[model samples]
Target: MKIKLGLLYGGKSAEHEVSLLTARAVSQAINFDKYEVYPIFITKVGEWIKGNPLMGPVDTVESLKISKETIRPNSITSFLPIDGDDASHLDVIFPLLHGPNGEDGTVQGLLEVMNLPYVGNGVLASAAGMDKVVMKQLFNEAGLAQVPYVHFIRNEWKNSQTALLQKMEGNLKWPLFVKPANLGSSVGITKVANREELLTAVEVAFKYDRKIIVEQGIVARELEMSVLGNDEPRCSIAGEVLPTKDFYDYEAKYEDGTTNYAIPAEVSPELLEKMKDAAIRAFKVLDCSGLVRADFFVTDDEEVIINEVNTLPGFTPISMYPKLWMESGLAYSDLIEELIALAMERFEEKQ
Candidate 1:
């Protein structure tokens, strides 16, 4: 019998469009003969719509746009198995969501309560990874070297704006990067070189989340490596993000053709070894499962600094996660299969 797999995508987050694209890409890459694929789409306005099992691979994104009649916004009773509501049971779930709400452990908690197996990080890992401040703390505990950063909640910033500004200015250097602490895909991120810009950037970041993070910017090459498996996770070869734009923001990462990537980046053996050590350390420290994308900054002096770990990184055809794995001799289809297997393995282990 073919295993039942649910492609959970299109969440109530800023990365909704990216989730849609990932759903389509996974549908195309999934081995239809081995798994009965179903679509569990969460609408932009927070509707959970379960689509029928895909007969075969899809070619367009529109086909994966699963929708249904209104059933109240933010209500998951339509498909979610809660309050004894019988959801279409699946062997496992592949959540292709990013950013807040879905990728930040809220959805993972739901899955855990339902006793369902879903691909990627568990609650603690997802929650911590989504919050920049928390992730940095965990990294520090793991003896990981990271750039200097400061974080604050909304009320703290409001009550002590002057003190917070002074704290940031005194602790961090110029050319700071302000971001929403619990968001991804560069949704609410700003690079500021002065106080005026810093004030504006904080307000901008507040538009997305209650917490904010300000990191001291560095002139280093952006490198990323993919980690897979559970207890014995391994790291793939590193990939370099060569963005022509000033910063690797949303527009530069997904919008136009301003960004270029170098697969299997040219790194010395020592550098690669250092990155592998850091990536695996980041993965193990968070107790991550299924997969993770460990992004880093390598200075000219070959210093490897842990930037962050994307619990559920992008799986698009051009996403750095899968691209690095592919360059390491794992095909896209095989990579998806490995992730599914990892999910099942983790689920069974917990039993």
Candidate 2:
């Protein structure tokens, strides 16, 4: 019997548009013969909408323009199990969401309460992976190499910017990256060269999230590797990103199509092996299941520093996660199948 898969995408997050794009890609690649797909789109206003228009192309912004006829806006819908009983339907949920509310364990928690099986990590893993501060702590505890940084709550920043600035300056120097702790796809991120830009950067970051992270900027090459499966996870061939801007900012990641990626990045076999090992280690440390894309920074000294791990990585055709897997000998269709199977396996294990 074909599995009934609910492809969940879009959400109350800054990366909502990106999530839509990812859903579109996954919808196109999934094998129809093996699984029946249900497109579940979550609007930016936190409403779940059911429709076909949600799984369209990302190039045309018009496809994303919600129409009254295409979707039942502000309505709650239900999914049934593939078999067994009429009330029990959907076999599993495949979340294609990116940042914050979608990828930060909130959705996972909802799924847990609903007794639904979903792809990727659970609540604890998702929450830890989404928060830069928390992820860094976990990485440190795991003996992983990561950049030094500091974090503060919104109340702390609001109480005394001077004190916060002093604390940041003492721990990290200029050219620091100020980012919202719970955001991804480089949203609300600013690279402050000095004190002149630091204050503005903090203000901009606080607008997106209550927790903010300030990390010491590392002048290094940006690289990413994909990890698939659970327990004994496998790593994909390394890929390098050449951002159009000074850093991979919001525009460089999504808006600006000028940024380029080098699949199977030209690095020595030794370095590649090291990075792949680190990626697997990072994935296992977070208790991630299904798939994940571990991002790293290769410094001038050739030291690999774990930047972050994306539990629900981007799925656009141009996304590095899928591209890396393709380069590692897995086609787009096969990758989707593998993820679905992994999700089912994880569900059965939990039961």
Candidate 3:
């Protein structure tokens, strides 16, 4: 029998539009002969809706607003209980969400409580991977190479600019990146050149999240590797992203579409091997399952520093995650099948 797969996407995240793109790509890639796909879309207002209208080509934001159905929280149409008599009701849930409420363990926690099988990492790993500050701390504790960073609460910056500036200057240097700790897709991120820009950047970042993180910006090549499976995960050939700006900002990533990626990135074989090794280590360290896209930065000196891991990386036809795997010899349909098998395996293990 074909498995009933609930594909969850879109959420109250800065990356909501990107999530829609991912959902559309995933829904199209899955083999219909092996599984039945259910598209569950969440709106920007945090409404979990169901229906065929939610799935879209998603070339623009205006299209999603018109196509999506709004679902109320805890409504029978919104959430499904795992204890129902029909065990075949929903074989698994594949979350193609990005940023805060979607990829940051909030949705994973709900799945765990509901006893539902879902793809990707569990609560702890999802939460750890979402918070830049916390993820960096865990990486540091694991002896992983990463850029130095400092975190600040919103109130600290709001109430006392004098002390906050003093602490940041003392701990970090100029050319720092101020970011909302819980956001992704390069949203609410600013690369400050000096002290004056730092204050404004902090204020802007705080508007998006309660906590903010400032990291010493690294001038290095951006590399990414896609990992698959659990326990002993496998890494794909490394890929390099050539951003169309000073950095991979929001505009460069999605809007301009000028960004180009080189699969099997032009790097020394030794350096490539090291990056793959580091990527797998970081994935296992975080107890991640299913699939994760690990990003890294290779310095001029050949040192590899992990950037961050995306538990639910983008899934658009042009997305790097699927592209990397395709270059590594896995077809899009095969990749989807593997993820489903892994999710079912993880569920069985937990049961």
Indicate whether candidate 1 or candidate 3 has the larger lDDT. 1
TM-scores, one per candidate: 0.95, 0.90, 0.91
lDDT measured at residue 90 in model 2 versus the true structure, 0 to 100: 71
lDDT of 1 by residue, 226-283 (tens): 9999999999999999989888999998888899888989899999999999999999
lDDT (C-alpha, whole model) for all candidates: 0.89, 0.81, 0.82
lDDT of 2 by residue, 1-351 (tens): 877777887888777787777776776677777776766767878767544423332454345444332333322235434334543367788888888777889888877766788888889889999988888888887788988898999898878878878888998967899999987888889999999898889889999889999999998999999999987899889999998678987788777786888998988888898898888888878888888889999987779999999988888877898899888889988988888888778888888
Q: Which 10-residue window of candidate 2 scores lowest in summed lDDT?
A: 68-77
Task: Give the candidate number with the greatest TM-score.
Answer: 1
Better of 2 and 3 by lDDT: 3
| Candidate rank order under TM-score | 1, 3, 2
Query: Per-residue lDDT of 1-351 in model 3, one digit per residue for the tens?
Result: 877788787788777777777766675667777777666768778777665522323345444443455667565424554435353257688888888877889988888876778888889889999998888888887788998788878777768878878887887877999999987789999999999898889889988889999998999999999999987799999999998688899989889988988987988889988998888888978889988899999999999999999988887768899999999999987888888889889989988
Instruction: Name the runs in model 3 displaced over 4 angstroms.
Output: 52-71, 76-88, 158-160
Model 2 segments more than 4 A misplaced? 51-77, 80-88
